[model samples]
Target: MDLDNLIVMANRIGLFFAAQPDRDEAMAGIAEHVKKFWEPRMRSQILAAIGTEAGAGLSEIVAAALTTHRAMLQPA
Candidate 1:
């Protein structure tokens, strides 16, 4: 899948979870959703986006979630 498309999808997931009242809970929801639903390759690509210029398009919430929960999101 395209990186741009993955970024858009991840951001959309973040948007959905952003409605949650608790910030931690929303970030967790975003992480869990991707961990459970996204394939390892997809997960790897998204994780690679963090702190990189290609990921500049990522929404703030999505970028934070990726940065905050990187340990678990990493693909073995």
Candidate 2:
């Protein structure tokens, strides 16, 4: 999978939820969207990108949401 593309997609998702009045809800929405929609492999790929230079492409919200809800987003 293309990590750059995934980061772009996730950043888009974060942009959408960032408008929410509630910060926590926005974060939850981002996590839930990825968890429910992304395949396990996709999820794993994106998760691995966190905190690395490749992950720097991620927006603040995407990075934070991914980091904050990591446990929940992790594929079994």
Candidate 3:
């Protein structure tokens, strides 16, 4: 998937998790959702995008989740 699509999807997940009462839980939810549902390449592409200007398009929550839970999102 393209970077834009990934950002959109991530933001969508962020939106869902943002409704949670706990900030930490919301962040973890975003990471877990991506890790569980997105393919390895999709995670890799998003990780790469996180290092570039394109990543600026990511929502604040998504960016925070990406930064806070990067290790979990990595391919294994």
lDDT of 2 at 75: 92
**lDDT of residue 11 for candidate 3:** 92
Best-matching candidate per lDDT: 2
| Residue 41 Cα positional deviation in candidate 1, in Å, after optimal superposition | 0.5
Clashes of 1: 0
Candidate 3 lDDT, 11-62, residue by residue in tens: 9999999999999999999999999999999999998887579898998888
lDDT of 2 by residue, 7-35 (tens): 99999999999999998999999999999
In candidate 3, position 57 carries an lDDT of 90
TM-score for candidate 2: 0.97
Model 2 ranges off by over 4 Å = none
TM-score of each: 0.96, 0.97, 0.94
**Candidate number that wins on TM-score, 2 or 3:** 2
lDDT at position 52, candidate 3: 77
Per-candidate RMSD, Å: 0.7, 0.5, 0.9
The clash tally of candidate 2 reads: 0
